[model samples]
Target chain A: MWQALYDEVKNEDFMIIAVAEESRGNETAKEWLDLAKPSYVTLIDREHHVADLYNMVNVPQAVWIDEHGRIVRPAETAGSHDAWRSMNREDMSMPEESTAIAAKAQKTYMDAVRDWAINGTMSKHAFNSAQVRTHLALPTENVALANTNFRLGFYLREHGQVEEGDKFLKIAVDLRPESWNLYRQAMNLREIGPNGFAANEDFFARVDALGAGRYYPPPNIEGFPTEAGFVPVS
Target chain B: MVTVLTEAGATEVVSAQATGDDLWFAKTDVTRATGWNLKPEGLCQGDLCVPVPKANSENFVREETVNIAGFWRLLGRPALHDQAGATWMLGASASDRANALQSLEAPDFKLPDLDGKLHSLSDYRGKRVFLTTWSSW
Candidate 1:
């Protein structure tokens, strides 16, 4: 857990940056950061500008920025190799005792970290310029459109002026209707905003159309796309 | 030199339209209910020429699952695809193709800490700050 890591690394020369338009007042984020005692920076982005800036499509994705403000690594929890991956197919399909592959991956990554901490740049796990570049590209056009609309819709519902964000959000629904985040956004927009767009039939129609016969909402929230247009079918 | 991502069903080549800078982008007539960007493959919006597979190759991607990493790969005109309901994503062919989504930054913001004081990025201008986001879910 990050709390554990914070206990370990919180006092070093480096600082901690918690990204999220996560908390509103100090009690939530500040309390934790203070408890950890690291020079911490708690940030919020209801508009997902950071997500857009770093191309972070997932939560807890992180990039290490060196002292000069240059990125040491693109944002992702490569550090999380220590943690068990939650969405393993084996776990999803059959969870009795098939963690063999997962264990191997964990050990490999752990060993890699030890190597990096000891020798730094000499570690094989350390990414080079080319490797890092290969890993930091954004989504394609279709995906980009989905991403753009989903984000636009999110901001519109949460912060921006009404109506315009919803229009784009509807297209997002049409694009990736399986996206729960998008669907949730649309619903929430209707629930809260100045638009007061009614819980229209068109919205449900979009959700129905998303998965069509196959779009099954994953039981685990983390496994689903946190984008627009995806409605939970049940 | 544009690239397109699409929900290219078995018959079509892409699902979504094409989007990028302007290098590989132009225009196309492939329009349906499926969402698509309107860019081309192999032209730089700047100096980047994102490629997209025309027909068959594009269908393969459309037929597959779309993940964050998968979407990032399909940036330029490199390759594309779509499925019936699943989101369509393309694969970028730029040798410099990096996964952009994984490296995004947290936006600048000012929120009151557990205390009543509002904290801003400007407050840390001269300092080195590391912010981490923790989630119970």
Candidate 2:
């Protein structure tokens, strides 16, 4: 999907740089990169620095920065295709109703991206300066604390201190339960018994709790004046 | 293990753990851990300098260690140390955020590519950069 976007906007003035938000360079990353062979710059974010800088709480989030280095659009849900989302919830086998609805509501962010890429700031897809500022989430006290805990947890775990790491990791999850990567990475590394970190929740269990529909935050699609036009999880 | 990335694209490493609210770094490693070195000019990092409070000097710099939380307080930045004393994190001060918002400039940060070559947002100042964050899982 990203490859298609790259090919479509390859001649545009702006550059599309994809960041891998994995904790470290792993085999899956290498395999995907090799298979896709993206022509655009593909960078690795072993420390999730971009996530921290952009306030990204989930994967596949895109932030548009204009020529002046100012963020014209804050992080929002982004996907290149809507093929799978076209299916009706009734046709799906997923047990959770919300999950099925969410799956169906996914939108193609590439349309907005293409418009902005071709037209620059004049694109209707681009939000104005004031709007962009309003859209940006201010760093709250809890967010800052959560970020610190995540960093500490990652650092400890990386240095062969699993028990010590889980202590801080649990606090991080408690602080930012919506941030998927925080708990995702933890679950990937451990079995996480009933007393597991993060409110004793695992990945699948939490998703079930959120209902599949609320898993991904709705895309802040450009030109959608009414909230109804936004991605509908229900 | 703590990794500190300065706005100027410098990276510092500090091996310390929080034993409470206090983060203890080795006395010999304080300078390398934080760009600011202990000196008469207060704690200096490049041209940026912050004066060490006379009252908190002892707590800031112990016999062979530095209390990162205390030192960060002196520098006017926010910091946190884990309960296990196994990790620490520091964030920009309120003033820093205000300045960035006022100037409308994205904060500069450096991250390495797959090959470990560093890339700074400042490096792409003249070009429009689309940064997308994704995960395999």
Candidate 3:
């Protein structure tokens, strides 16, 4: 867990730069950050410019850039080695078909991160060279298109154009039927009419576990609490 | 879940089309960025809120005329008008288009430690920061 690692490293003198494009203070997220008491810096990237540099498509992405600022290695989804079930996975029950497939995917992803971290460029998992080509090949053309659509949808939503956002969201969902987050985002915005406000602010903010008002308030509208003594209008 | 807190509360959900101060479209002024309480009580869905007056019985009604024009100018929210009325929605006040990875980055955020000083990403420039975000199973 990056948090666990951050906690371990923050006490030292390491300056951790966490770039986030979303607002923080989700109830639970705040709680954990509090508990960790990290000494490093966490940056918010509302525009996600930093993420563009790292070529990151998701959170928990990491790249070990040396002091010279050169990426010692390409980006990776950081995970602890011990987090894996084990390289020598034996027979496991095929619970539900979906769960079984998920298990397999999880193993592959975990193994990749562990191997990459442990060996670095030399690690068998590093796909920087020819040997890595087989496993580390980039996404195909279709997959790339899907990613683009999803991105466009996000832009539309954050820009307050839900219908346009939904068009891309729909394309993304059709492309990656298995992506949970993508599906979740699309589903949330699908029914949001041009006139409808995202009422799910309660749902999403709570999903992040931050007890707060909706994530983004209507642009420029400032609402505050009235004086307590004054009688409320009916 | 519904509550009948007051007998005189108006239930009609008025959609404001920003035209002018008097008959100004409501949409012209109110935005998602400021807060959408719908109710006069100022109880927005998330952490953000707009201060409005309300009684226990009519939390969702507009008890007072919002200074729509003032907010329109102050916040600079986008506005749209047609022959009949004008409409406005919050602009992307913060983030724009993002990828899964980009969106993964929560906005730059720091909170007061037990000591109460604000903290930020610059605080940890030299050291490696590993921020692990997780969900409860």
Candidate 4:
């Protein structure tokens, strides 16, 4: 999705910056990065600095900053149309419900992105200041604690203190069971090699456990006309 | 990776990144190391709320690294980061939640590219930027 966007806007003064929240240029992250070979800029956030900075609770969340450095759009789902449509149950071995969720998210996300690309702030897809502030996730007390515990646990695990790290990690997960990034990272620690996901708790299994109904917080593109296709919203 | 020294003991943290001025730890690491998380109410721990003064609220958080020095300062604890040694000595868990508000701009942070060169948000200040956060796992 980004590659195609990069191509379209290469002539324009637009930059697509991909921040790897937990990867930090590790082997598992590299495997996917190598495959994509993104022409755009890719930065590694080993400690999830970007996630905290943006209050991003999920991967592939996008924040659009205007040329003046103001946030034209707060972080929201930004999946590409191709990714959602290409998910094959037969080929990928994902459950029907998981794929359905992906498809739903990607369609809305891609349409909004494309509109923003063509129309810039004029795109109704972009939220106003009030809307942006209203939509951005406000960290609750539990969220804040969970974020802290997850960070500490992740650091301990990284420095060969698995037992200690797991204690905090468990607290983090238990604090915010819906935080997929935290849950996914914790599960992937025991996983070997640079494989993408494929952990003991697979993505779909976790999603199913969480119930596909609660998998993704609803896309925050409300009031932007969901059925408008690519039409600019004045 | 960076070294963290606490009263309990000295431990190395793999994810802490050092920028020139501040030793930044992710909110996760901050929670792990300091036991404070930025919540809607304030920088909070278990039933404890830390009041962050308004003056010190200027871009205290960059990227996602909470300013250990500033945070400790807010908590009125002495903290130091040895740049040359790449070490951070944390005093104690203070109520370091000064920059806990939601209206702040995303803090400027320098991160490494695939080749290990550092890049800052100021580098792309003039252009429309789409910052996407993701991971393989």
In order, candidate lDDTs are 0.40, 0.63, 0.37, 0.63
Q: lDDT per residue, candidate 2, B1-137, as tens digits?
A: 65443333334445564656767677666676665676676667788777766776777666766776677766667576545443456665545554454455666677766667877777777666777876665
Deviation in Å, model 3, residue B87 alpha carbon: 17
Find the 10 residues in a row with the least total lDDT in model 4 chain B: B92-101
lDDT of 1 by residue, B12-43 (tens): 33333333311121123233322343344532
Residue B62 Cα positional deviation in candidate 2, in Å, after optimal superposition: 5.8
Worst 10 residues of 1 chain A by lDDT: A217-226
Of 1 and 2, the candidate ahead on DockQ is 2
Clashing pairs counted in every model: 84, 6, 55, 5
- Candidate 1 global CA lDDT score: 0.40
Error of 1 at B37 (Å): 29
* Alpha-carbon lDDT of model 4: 0.63
Each candidate's TM vs. the true structure?
0.43, 0.75, 0.36, 0.66
Candidate 3, residues A1-234: lDDT per residue as tens digits? 344444533344333455433322232234445665555454433223344333344444555432223233344444312112112223433235434433444455445444433444554443332322222213333344444455545654665766766676677667654332344435434553222222244433333442222221111101211112111122
lDDT of 1 by residue, A32-118 (tens): 456565434555444344444554444445554433344545545432221122233233342223244334433443344334334
Q: After superposition, how far is residue A58 of candidate 1 from its true place, in Å?
A: 1.7
Candidate 3's TM-score reads: 0.36
Worst lDDT 10-window in candidate 2 chain A:
A224-233
User: Which sequence of candidate numbers ranks them by DockQ, best first?
Assistant: 2, 4, 1, 3
- In Å, residue B95's CA in model 1 sits off its true spot by 15
Q: After aligning candidate 3 to the native by TM-score, how far in Å is the CA of B86 from where it should be?
A: 17
Which is better, 1 or 3, measured by DockQ?
1
